[model samples]
Target: MDRTAAPGQSHTTPSTALAYLNPRYWDERFSEEEQYEWFKDYSHFRHLIHSHLTPNCSVLELGCGNSQMCEELHKDGATDLTCIDLSHVAVDNMQRRLLSRGLKDIKVLQADMLELPFGDECFDLVIEKGTMDVLFVDSGDPWNPKPETISKVMATLKGVHRVLKANGIFISITFGQPHFRRPIFNAPDFSWSVEWTTFGETFHYFVYVLKKGQRSSYEDIPVKRFEVPHVNLLHEELESEDFAFLINVDELNC
Candidate 1:
C-alpha cells in the first residue's frame, strides 16, 4: 500500500473502494499488514491535532485502524482514550500491541461509527484520520455524490455530533476540500462552527476543526441539497473507475 497517497485516495485498480467499506477486507488486510497509517504518520498531524488534547480529556478515535495514533497520544499523557473500528482483526491486534508496549488505559473496541454505541455528551474530543473519507470511497461523481453516499456520511457524522459534549471538538483530517465538506459539517441540523487548517504542500490535506456549539449561516457556499439524483452513478461507475477521489488541485485551494 502506498502510504504517501492523498486522502480519499483509491487504493488500487481492483475495485478496492468497495473493499474499504467492508470489514472482511480490512480483517484480512490487518491480519497480514499488522501496521499501517492511512495518511501521514502521527508525527505529521501532531501539531494540528495535539492542541486539542489534554491529559484528563476523554477522547474517542473513530475507525481506528492499525494507526498508532491513540498509543502515541497515550504516551503524550492523554490516558483516557477509546478507539473503535469495525475490523475485529484490527481491534485484537491493537489490543495486543498496546499491551505489549505496557500501555493499558486506552480501550480498543470493535464498533461501527455510523451507530456510535455511546450516550450523549460523553467525549471531550473525537478524532478520525482518513476514516470518514472512506464513506466517499465508492461515492460517484466528486461533484454529485449518490444519495446513499451522502446518507452514510451524514448518518456517521451525525452520530459523532451526538456523542460530543457541548463545545467538544471533532478533528477530521482529509483531502476533502472545504467546498465539498464544509456543508456537511455545517449542516443545519448540526450546531457547529466549521473551521479548517490546511497541510501538505503538493496535495493539500485539511484538518477540519468543528466545535460542537457554534452555528454557521453557510454564507456564500453552495450547499448541495441532499435530495436523490436522477442518475444511477453506482450503476454507471462500476463499469469504469474502481474509485473516485480524482479532483483538480487547481480547483481546491484550502
Candidate 2:
C-alpha cells in the first residue's frame, strides 16, 4: 500500500517486502498451461548458455516454474540438477513433468529465493527467467516498490555467489531498457558485475553470468555490438525502467 516509503528502504528483510508478496498468487496465475508455456519457452537464454553448459554439471534453476528449460538442460546432457520455486504447487507440477519422462536426476524444492535451503557455491550454474519480471509486475506502485525487486534479486545473487564454485556461473533474464540500472545497495560482501542491454521490442533482459572470487574465467558470449535509440523518460513516469550500457562481461574480465 505504501509505495514511496523511502528510497533505499531495507528491501533485504524478508519480513519487510517478501512477506507481503505471495507465491500462491503466482502459482494460481501460472497454473494454466498457457502461463507455463510462456515461462518455459526461453529461446534467448538457451542461445546464450547452449555453449557454456555441459553434461554432469550441477545446475540450479531458480524460480523453476512450470517450465521445461530444466528438462531441456537435462536432455542436453546435464546430470545433477536442483530446481527451486516459491510455490509448492508449481514445484509439484514440475516434479510430475520430470517423473513422466522417467527422469531421476532432478530435485525440485519449494523455497523462497530470499531464503534458500542450500550451501554456498553448491551449483555450477544458476538460471532465472520470468521470475524478476513477475516481481516488478506484482509489486504495486505509489510506493513504487520495484527497488525491493533489486534488493531481493541481489540477495539471491549473493546466495549464488556463495554456493557457486569459482568457475561457476549465474544467468538471469528480465525485461527493461539498454542502460537500465537498479540499486543493489544491500550486497556489499559479494562482488558481482553485470552486462545487460535491450533486445527486441519492449523486452530488454540482462544476462547476469555471476561468478564468485573474480572475473578471471567469465566471458561474454561472442556477438556483435549494437545500440538502440534512447527514449528519454522521467524516472517517475515509467512503470518499468530501462537504460544504456556502461560495461560488458568482456570489459569486466579484462
Q: Each model's TM-score, in the order given?
A: 0.82, 0.66
> Which TM-score value belongs to model 2?
0.66
Q: Compute the lDDT for candidate 2.
A: 0.56
Q: Which whole-number lDDT from 0 to 100 does residue 1 have in model 1?
A: 14
Candidate 1: give the clashing pairs: none
Q: How accurate is candidate 1 locally (lDDT)?
A: 0.74
Instruction: Residues 53-112, candidate 2: write the lDDT tens digits.
Output: 866778888888666778888777777889998887778878888888898779999987
lDDT of 1 by residue, 1-254 (tens): 12533344332323434666776777776776656675567887788877788769999999888888898878776789999999898899899999998888889999999899999999999999888877887666666677998898999989999999999999998767776787677767788888898876544578999988876565335565553323323422432322224221112111
The candidate that achieves the highest lDDT relative to the unseen native structure = 1
| Local accuracy by lDDT, each model | 0.74, 0.56
Measured with C-alpha atoms, the lDDT of residue 3 in candidate 1 is 54
Best by TM-score: 1
